[model samples]
Target: MSEPTQSSPTRPPTPSALSSRSDRQFEILILALASVIVLVFVLSIYLLGSESWPALQRFGLEFFTQRTWNPVEGVFGAVAMITGTLVTSLVALAISVPLAIASALFVAEYAPKWLANPVGYLIELLAAVPSVVYGLWALFVIAPVLSRWEQGFFQDPARLALYTSCKNLWDSGSTTLQCFFVPSTFDGRGLALAIIILTVMILPYTASVARDVIRLVPQEQREAMYALGATKWEVISRAILPYARAGIMGGVILALGRALGETLAVAMVIGDSQDVLKSLFGGASTMASVIANQFGDAQEALHRSSVVTLGLTLFFLSVIVNYVARLIIARLTPKGIQ
Candidate 1:
């Protein structure tokens, strides 16, 4: 029995036992890397809040309600800028979402491989173009066409009379009537132009994300719908789109964030007016546009703080938008996936 006895074979280490010094070091490294983003985000908020405290103290809630922005007079408010930002972003979202979704559907479901690849690639490439380039293009190419149209519209006697009547109503304390007609002074380089440029600028973001998400819908979903005698459109609308709605929504929100934060392009074409929006074609300024246009020239401490406050407001606005988007996505996502 002693002669027959042998040493037992060695066993492999368990996963827990296999955690070596290198493994721990790698994990620590990953954790440190992940912490950097959070650190940066918190630091940004702190810096903005510190710099903007004076403005916040002085204006309180009035900063958002007041429309005046006079650096020389030491008065500043964000109502006009905030309105412009929201209007431009929302209008751009409304225009881009449908077009982007349609393009994504065409590329993902209808187009053959030969066509889909190129079209999808081109759409994705649009996002790579710089904002400055889009501004330059819009300023030189698109703005002139819009200006011509405006000139023609104003030249018509009937339209001119209608605008005059609206102006009379506006002067008679019917302030809301101003939305019905373009400002007589509008030269087309204002809210309408800004909306158009923002729409184009944000289109690629939604399209690319949607295309990828639509493609990811399971084959079984399509097959099941098809077996039930669904048409192609019906299958897509009922089966695939429902499954991919969460992802499509994510893309729409991403585009909206882009429209909200767009600076140089909007500043270049937004007409830079500091008044409340009076018409679709009237001059207006967004928060990002104001910050870009005024920060360097902000000589007074209050003025500088006000500019910083605008930046802070924009930061919070973006955070709120993303948080709302997350909630919506969570609610829309299938329970099984959640």
Candidate 2:
């Protein structure tokens, strides 16, 4: 019976000894690099933690929420700076995202290739300039320009009506016979300046990445939507945005990371006030610029430690923001689909 049975066909060679061996080698190399990257991250966190742990222990969580930052009293609260950083970053993102996506869509879907490259380069060049230049530009050029413009916008009667109450309008026995005193010039330096400069800088990055995402969308997908009676805008809205949401969010994440760490530009434009306020026009410090401006001159050890702690705070906030962006994109991604 054994002799009668046909001999089994020869089996294939082990993958370990054949084409898959190269894959294994590449994977091992990638693992080694990944390990190094992880080690670097851990080491940086350890170093910062070691340096700032004393201040953290001394101040406890109170350091984060306190308003005052008195060095003589050893009192340090990051609340204002934290508020400034978050608010300005949010403003910049709000200003840039819609424009960036729109530009990307237009370039990828509507604009001629000849026009797109030059325009894209022009946008990208903004990020190439030094931050100090941006800061100077903001202070000298951008702030005054906005000061003039927003002075009118904020003073508009329409805005006054939109407000919950017109009661808050200037009412110092107004020189005018008007019932509601029109608002005057707002602070040109603080959030307005920071947001504008940040928007300019982040535009290149956000637009570039978004453009790439739109470009990656298959032509066939757009055509199929068109075949089903979709207009160009409809096709992009239904097909392109749905497919490229993750990529656009990734760009936003990248821009946010860049904006948060920005120092010189923010420092120059964000009027150096320690006070926190509900108004975006209120001047305040940010963690990066504060440390940059203070660390070298900080006389006391505790003061230096506090500045370092601010740096650590910035790092932590950045990581948290990045994680949140990832979670948002993940949630937005279509399940059981690419």
By lDDT, the best candidate is 1
- The local distance difference test score of model 1 is 0.86
Model 1 RMSD, rounded to 1 decimal: 5.5
| Model 1 lDDT per residue over 160-211, tens place | 8878887776567455654545763556688888999999999998898788
TM-score of each: 0.85, 0.74
lDDT values of the candidates?
A: 0.86, 0.77
Which stretches of model 2 miss by more than 4 angstroms?
1-40, 147-187, 322-338
Residues 1-338 of candidate 2 have per-residue lDDT tens digits of 12434445784434455657877888999999889989988987998888888789889898898988888788888887888788778779989999989888777888798998877787778779999999998899878876776576656677756332423432232122242222232547776678888898888778887887788777799999999999888998999899988878888987898889999999887777665543355466788878877888899878888888898888888898778766765665444335
Give candidate 1's total backbone clashes: 0
Q: 49, model 2: CA deviation in Å? A: 1.4
Model 2, residue 69: C-alpha shift (Å): 1.6
Would you list the clashing residue pairs of candidate 1? none
